[model samples]
Target: MTVMRFDNVSKVFYTADSETVAVDDLSFEVHKGEFVAIIGPSGCGKTTILSLVCGLMSPTEGKITLSGDKKVGYMLQRDQLFEWRTIQSNIRLGLEVQHVDSKVNRDYADDLLKRYGLWEFRNRYPRQLSGGMRQRVALIRTLATDPDLLLLDEPFSALDFQTRLDVCDDVYDIIKKENKTALLVTHDISEAISMADRIIVLTKRPAHVLTVHETHLGDIDTPLKRRESPSFAKQFEVLHRYLNGGNAV
Candidate 1:
C-alpha cells in the first residue's frame, strides 16, 4: 500500500515583487516500509520536498497525501540534540511535546535505547557521545514518536567520511528493523544508491522528477553490504549522470 503520494505537486516562494518556483508538478509514491531517497542538483529545492511532506510548508498546486495519521518524524542535517539534556531525556522530549508522555511510551523509548546498545550512554549528555552515537540518539528520539514515516534531511552530512558510512549503516538497520517507511533527501550519490530501495532524481530549479531507479543488489544484508556489491559503482554512475543533466542510460 502507498504510505505517501505527491501528485503533480508544485511549490512557489513569493517575495514583495518576485516569485520563484521550486518544485514543479512532481509526483511520486512511497510505499509502506520502503526506503526512498531524493537526489538533485544543489539549489534544486531538495530540502523543500521534505518540508512539504512534514507540513512545514504547503505546496502551491496539486496534492500531497500521506497514509495513516500523517504522523511524520523528521531528522535534520544536524543531530539537533540539546547539549544540556541527557540522551534518555532527549529521547523523551518528543513524547513530552506531543503531550503523550506516558509509562508505556516511555518504556518503549527506553527499550529502543537498550535494544540499540545505547542503554549505557543514556545518562550521558550529547557532548559526551561521538558523532555517530549522537546521530543514533537522534534517530532514537525520532522513532520514539512512533511516526508513520520518517523524513531524513542529510542526517549524516555533518559527519566525516568514515563516520558517515557507519552512521548510514546504523540508521538503515534501525529503519528496516523497525519496519518504517522513510524518505531521505541527500546529495551523496553513493549514499543514496546503497541505502534507498528506490531513488528519485530531480531536475534543477523548478524541480521535477527526472527519473527513478529501483535497486536490486542481491544478497545484501545491510547498506554497507550493498556498497560492497559490484553493482554499487554502476548504480552510482547512473545517478551521477542524471544529476549532471545527462540522459539516463
Candidate 2:
C-alpha cells in the first residue's frame, strides 16, 4: 500500500526580488511499513520535501497526497524535548496537543516506554538522560501519537559520532518493531544505506530524483549490522558518486 505519494511536485520560495526553486518535478512514493531515505548533496532541499509531506508547506505545483487519514509524526534534527517536562510528560505532549489523551492512548504510550526500556526514567527531565537516551525519548514521544507515517529530518545529526551510530540502531529498531512507515532526509550516504530499505538520491539544487537504489543487504536487522555487511561499502560508493555528479550505474 502507498502511504504517501509526491506526483510531479515542485516547491518554490519567492522573495521580494527573486524566486528560487527548491524542488522541481520531484516524485516518489513511500509504501506502508517501508523505510525510505532521501540522500543528496548539501543544500539539496531535503527538509523542504519533509515540510511538504507534513503540510508545513505546500508544493507550488503538482500534487502531494497522503493515503486516507494518515497522521504524520515529525522527528527533527535535535531531540527538541522540553527540559521542564519529565520524560513521561514529554511523551504525552503530542497526545495532549492532538486532544487524544484518553486512557487507552496514555496506556499505549506507557506500554511503549516500558517496552523500550525507558520506564525507569519516566520522571526524569530531558537533561537527566544521555544524548542517546534523549533521542529514544524523542522517538517514543513521536510514537505516542500513533502516527501512520513518520518524517525524520536528520534525526540523529545532532549527536556525536559514536552516539549517532548507537542511536541510529535504536531508532531503526523502534520504527520497525512498531511496523511504521518512515521517510528520512539526510545527507549521510552511509547512514542512509544502513537504515533505509530504499534510498532516493536527489540532484543538487532544484532537487529531483537522480536515482533510487534498493538496498539488498539480506536479513540484516540493525543499522550497525547493515554497516558491517559486505555490500555496505559497495552501495555507499554508488550513492557517493551519484551525489558528486558521476553517473549512476
Candidate 3:
C-alpha cells in the first residue's frame, strides 16, 4: 500500500522577499514498511520534505497524503530526553499527556525497556545512560504512541563513528523488529546505503528527484556489510556525482 506520497510538491520560503525555493516540483511515494532515505547536499531541502510529511510545515503547492492520517513520529539528531525524568517516567510521559496511561500500556513500555536492556536502569535519569542507550530511549519514546511512520533527521549524526555504527545496528534491529516504515534524511551516502531499501537523491536548492536507486544487499545485509560490498564503492561514487550535479558516473 502507498503509505505516504508527495504529488508535485513545492516549498517556497519568503523572508522579506528572500524567496528561497526549498523543494521544487518533487513527486514521490513511499510504500508501507519500507525504509526510504533521502540524500542531498546541504540546503537541498531534505528536512523540508520531512517537515511536510509530519504536518509541521505545509507544502507551498501540491498534495501530500497519508494513507489514513496516521500519526508520525520524528527522531532528531539528538535524543532530546529530559535529564530530570527517570527512564520509566520519560517513557510514560506520552501516555500521561494523552490520558491513555493504563496497566497494559505501561507494561508494554516496561517490556520495551527490558527487551532493549534498559530495564535495570529504568529508574535512572537520562544523564546516567550512555549516548546509544539514550537514543534507544528516545526511539522508544517515539514508539510509545505507535506511529505509522517515522521521520528520522540525521539521527546518528551527533555520535562518534564507532558509536554511530553500533547505534545504527541497535536502531535497525528495533525498527525492523517492530516492522515500522521509516523516512530517513541524511547527507551521508554510506549511511543511506546501509539503512535503506531504496534511496532518493535530490538536487541542490530548489530540489527535485535526481534519482531513486533500489538496492538488494544480499546475505550481507548491514550498514557495514553494505559498505564492504563490492557494489558499495561504485554506488557511493554514483551518488557522489549525482549530488555534485553531474550525470551518474
How large is the C-alpha RMSD of every model relative to the true structure? 0.9, 0.8, 1.4
Q: Candidate 2: misplaced stretches above 4 Å? A: none
- Residue-wise lDDT of candidate 3 within 206-245, one digit each (tens)? 9999899886773564667677788888888888888887
Candidate 3 structure lDDT: 0.88
Tens digits of per-residue lDDT for model 1, 178-233: 99999999999988988998999999999999998998852486888898898888
Clashing pairs in 2: none
Error of 1 at 235 (Å): 1.2
Candidate 2, 1-249: lDDT as tens digits: 999999999999999999999999999999999999999989989999999999999999999989968799999998899999999999999999999999999999999999999999999999899999999999999999999999999988889999999999999999999999999999899999999999999998899999999998638999999999988998988888898899756
Pairs with backbone N, CA or C atoms under 3 Å apart (clashes), candidate 1:
none
Candidate 3 ranges with C-alpha deviation above 4 Å: none
TM-scores of the models, in the order given: 0.98, 0.98, 0.95
Flag regions of model 1 displaced more than 4 Å. none
